[model samples]
Target chain A: EAGVAQSPRYKIIEKRQSVAFWCNPISGHATLYWYQQILGQGPKLLIQFQNNGVVDDSQLPKDRFSAERLKGVDSTLKIQPAKLEDSAVYLCASSPRGGGGNEQFFGPGTRLTVL
Target chain B: DQQVKQNSPSLSVQEGRISILNCDYTNSMFDYFLWYKKYPAEGPTFLISISSIKDKNEDGRFTVFLNKSAKHLSLHIVPSQPGDSAVYFCAARGFSGNTGKLIFGQGTTLQVKP
Candidate 1:
């Protein structure tokens, strides 16, 4: 079975420039997530989607970051006015369900370097 | 607050030796724990998992032991192979007013020398 897929394994952008990342989940997966991993730190959950509907996004900086899942299969995460602090890897993951004990399958991730 | 913590940033062991990685979590509500292995430039792969009710779970040469009283867990690899060299991350699943999100540690890079 194919795993989660992401586009543009690496990206470099200037400060204040906008960037977007794409993700395609595994077949029949109902839950999708976007996470940010800074240097030397664990991946932080930014947003979660369950079948095209939002489940949680409390940690997301709505002022600069946004995400959406269309048709419950593919999702996109966007950052506006990117800052130097946004120079980190943006990871996408999907799961069969959005409940406990369900393992999340991750993608290769998009490394965004904001100069 | 960092709920999950992996104190060791890295570890090195001989190919035939045993490797033990430790993790501690501050949240008592975390009911499930998991370990993921990751190579540079690749996504993390699920290694092993154990529920809170179980103290130990083993698969092949990997074993995960959880101590609820101490809120600590560990991953053990025996007769480690060179291919086992990778970053190991400890994650915990529990409801924190949000969906069941997994809190992860800083990750520990392991090097299994030939």
Candidate 2:
């Protein structure tokens, strides 16, 4: 089976600009997630989607970040008026249903660099 | 607050030696623990996992030991090889219905010398 796929392995944008990242999870996976990994830190969960519905997004910055999983197969994460602090790698992962020790499969991730 | 913590930022060990990485978690709700290995420019891959019900889990050269009383878990690699040089992250799963969301700790970078 193929792994999770993401677009634009790398991106560069200016401060106050807008940027979007897209992710296509593995086929038949029911859960998807987006995370941000800053330099020298662990990846922080930004949002999680179970099928077409959101399961958790409490840590996400509502003012500037938003994400959606349109048909439960693919998802997109957007950041408007990007800040310098937002410069980090955005990772996407997917897992099967029922969640009984199912390991998540991660994508290559989009490395966003905000100048 | 950082629920999970990996105190060591980096470790270096000679090949064929033993490597031990430690992690501590403050939350008692975490019922499952996992370890992931990551290479530069690549996403993390699942290495091993252990449920709170079990104190230890081993696969090949990688072994994970959990101590519920101390709220600590550790990964030990025997006969470490240069290919094992990478960042290792510890993650925990909380019991919140079907969320299955994992809380991760800051990773430890391991360098194995030949």
Q: DockQ winner among the candidates?
A: 1
User: Candidate 2's error at B25, in angstroms?
Assistant: 0.4
Q: What CAPRI grade goes to candidate 2?
A: medium
True contacts kept of each: 0.63, 0.49
Which residue pairs collide in model 1, if any? Answer: none
CA shift at A101, candidate 1, in angstroms?
3.5
lDDT of 1 by residue, B7-98 (tens): 99999999999999999999998989999998999988899999999999999999999999999999999989999999999999978576
lDDT of 2 at A49: 89
Q: Which lDDT value does model 1 have at B38?
A: 88
Candidate 1 to native Cα RMSD, angstroms:
1.0
Residue-level lDDT of model 2, residues A1-115, one tens digit each, is: 8999998899999999999999999999998999999988888889888899988888899999999999899999999989999999999999886252437888989999999
- Candidate 2 second chain TM: 0.97
lDDT tens readout by residue for model 2, B31-70: 8999989998888888999999999999999999999999
